[model samples]
Target: MVEHSGGHVVPFTLVASAAQAGQRTDRFLADAIGTASRSRVKALMQAGSVRRNGTVLRDAADPVRPGQCYSVEFPPAVAARPQGEAIALSILHEDDSLIVLDKPPGLVVHPAPGNQAGTLVNALIGHCGDDLPGIGGERRPGIVHRLDKDTSGLMVVAKTEAALAALSADFAARRIERSYLGLCWGMLTPAAGAIEGAIGRDPRDRKRMAVVARGGKPALTHYRTLEILHGAVSLVACRLATGRTHQIRVHLSHQGHPLLGDPVYLRRVPGPARLLDDATRRAALDFPRQALHAQSLGFTHPATGAFIRFSSEPPADFHALKAQITANSGSA
Candidate 1:
């Protein structure tokens, strides 16, 4: 018989059994629970719900002999209700530790002055409920990183303190890899290259990000041409080594290839790239916002310590733009 001392009751569904136990406590737990922390198992022992032959056991350090049936329960998960709104989300992956969402254009990352609702944070709050980690203040509890208001793509959020710390560290250390898909004007010279510059608020236009001369944080973006549309515009993939604000936008703009429809950077449209037809040129002039989409993300799991990668297809607008490129390719 084992002791039945109980503190926090955690119910677990037993799945399998070994040869009734002749094993070291840590080894047995490791075998029983694939990759669960030993400290968590020790905590279970302290709570005393772990049992052998229907009696509570007290020592996670206790040696075990063969022929004893062992079982344990886990604490109940805290209940929190996630608000479900009409806001659609392109959820790529979700777990206890985090959630990855493919944010679309026209959605801001966080709430701010004059824009409090209809943001990704607000949508996440509605979706994650009270389970979201409350670190980045109450307004943005689980938010770990950000994308600009007009940029869209795969973004991740932490659900727990450990996950938040790990994910933040991964970003800071540049261990997390991100790839973006975008369309920019002109036939890019060199076809593929890297852009390194300092980024700060524009002195001329405070609303836009600029590659400053004296007082901006350093930014770097590496880009490769994916396709050439009508021999004029190039669909590109930009990889971020250091995620500075408006990095890809500023870098590409600095390279003299501002994204199509990017109002702030390419204030005046350059003459159509040789690939544009009259109708396509008209469409380019009326297009709004820089075409940027987060297409890929790779990072390590905070809990399991396993590497995970996710990808998303370019959004509808991106495809439409590509279609226009293909349609007018031979005409140019």
Candidate 2:
């Protein structure tokens, strides 16, 4: 049977009949649920949303037992279409074909289940109105690339179908230039080098990305140490040769130089923290989000076929954190 309460699909119990015994649990649940697909049931099972006798069940291939009770909990549904909101924007360039803006930290670029409103998509819808082209769907924007919500950076949004097509092609062809500045916990041994790995979802932690040996997309990053502060942290510049979700963070972390204040990757206090004074250590530790900024972006203008580049300095908070570290470092 199905039950709903408080806008959530409450865990509903289902009993497998004798005829349904020995079926794959996912198949059985999918057939019994009626609305959810086998894939959906499998996903829920992987997420531990499906349980048998109150114990979480993760193996979708487990055989169903006759009269065994299973429970499934589905998360709340999100809005299909994001609505426009009058949020502020830091536009750098705007024209009929595209818009370039310095996206601030904490501003989500897309609407997702947890972040349904006040995203860059919502802001763009409000700013451009009907001028925004419907690229893949009415609900999506003409975003050819993306930045993590907490990673402030310059982003280009297409305003027309032609621009969207051209820019998407440019990104796919590796014709775009993107660079970032970040503060990491340790000095790079060589001061400059390249990181190449295949990035994919972490099997151990589904919500995070990792440099995996298999079933991942190849990603490369070139980096140089711009400065080393307190001999404890390094200010680094990175250039992306390929874009993958959390590629920079994952690659750097794999080298044991995880960006400071990266919640997902920086799980423990870096050993270099001991080199800093108490206050400097506190400043680094207190940083609320990843200390990375998209400093520069260059691309061929879709409508004009001219190379266009935009640059932005790190935000005030980023600079302030650096200043605090330097001040405590006793350096000139």
Candidate 3:
């Protein structure tokens, strides 16, 4: 019988496998777990879970050997609650129960293997000194939701155990409202529409997510065009009915209007000839990362049960990109 030792151990007995004989072990393992992301797979390898013939495989890039039986044990994740740092933060709201923050782009929410320090969690630890009422056995002190490193946005962090539980329940029940602003590659038609697609890890590349027809979680995103920039790009506002991993990025890309500057989803920049003009093309290229910003969040106060909301404007980078595009359109 094939020894796919299940549960915490992601083990596999390889014989008739298509993993390239010279491919990196991490990549091969990512391919093996069709629904797992490569970063996550790499993390598993780093945690000493990957094994080759009962030996711990330390190197992620170690080549796969044909016909070799390999096994992986996924250790239960331990959130290394980061040490407090003096990093500055833009606070929107703070009370005994929760703290709302306007997180800057490039600030990671929590610590993992490669991103060890200088995260928003570190700053929160400093700001909220010793008030963490711990959640879920892991050390992620009050963290409930996450925003990607490059996606600037607003987030709420829980302060006490009771608050954490209440906020978590709210999110799980879909009571929280999230709104985002995004710039995409083309002129998305109909002015407004809803995208209902299932999102899961891409079968071809585990490092990214995609809209898959099968074996994925249901996701819904509603979008309306806020503005059309030069007829080659658009500024869109999105509301999430269901939040799934990389849901907006995957759905928009699946719609053939991948977010501008999205490295993973955009794949290739729009050809210059396809764009409205040179300035618009350059605007697309110069925009550094996926142009996504979490603009607003609304929910009932975990403690008081009163509805409250907070809004934040885009940062300097986002504003400058929009200004340049708007200006260049007139010249063209």
Candidate number achieving the greatest TM-score relative to the actual structure: 2
TM-scores of the candidates in the order shown: 0.72, 0.79, 0.75
Flag clash pairs in model 3.
Answer: 38-206
TM-score of 1: 0.72
Encode model 3's per-residue lDDT on 1-332: one tens digit a residue: 12334433345445425546888888887787676677877887778777788788779889888878787665444445567889999999999989899999889888776677798887888887765625433447789899988899899988888888888898988999999999887777778999999988899999999888899999999999999876767899999999898889999999888887787888876643164556656766867888999999998998898999999999888888877777774434
Top candidate when judged by lDDT against the true structure: 2
Residue-level lDDT for 71 in candidate 3? 77
Between prediction 1 and prediction 3, which has the larger TM-score? 3
Question: Clashing pairs in model 1?
Answer: 10-73, 10-74, 10-75, 11-74
- Distance (Å) between predicted and true CA of 230, model 2? 1.4
lDDT by residue (tens digit), candidate 1, 202-254:
99989888999989988888889988876668899999988888889899988
> What is the lDDT of every predicted structure here?
0.78, 0.89, 0.81
Instruction: Score candidate 2 by TM-score against the native.
Output: 0.79
Q: Using lDDT as the measure, what is the rank order of every candidate, best first? A: 2, 3, 1
Candidate 1 weakest lDDT stretch, 10 residues: 76-85
Cα lDDT, model 1, residue 271: 54
Clashing pairs in 2: none
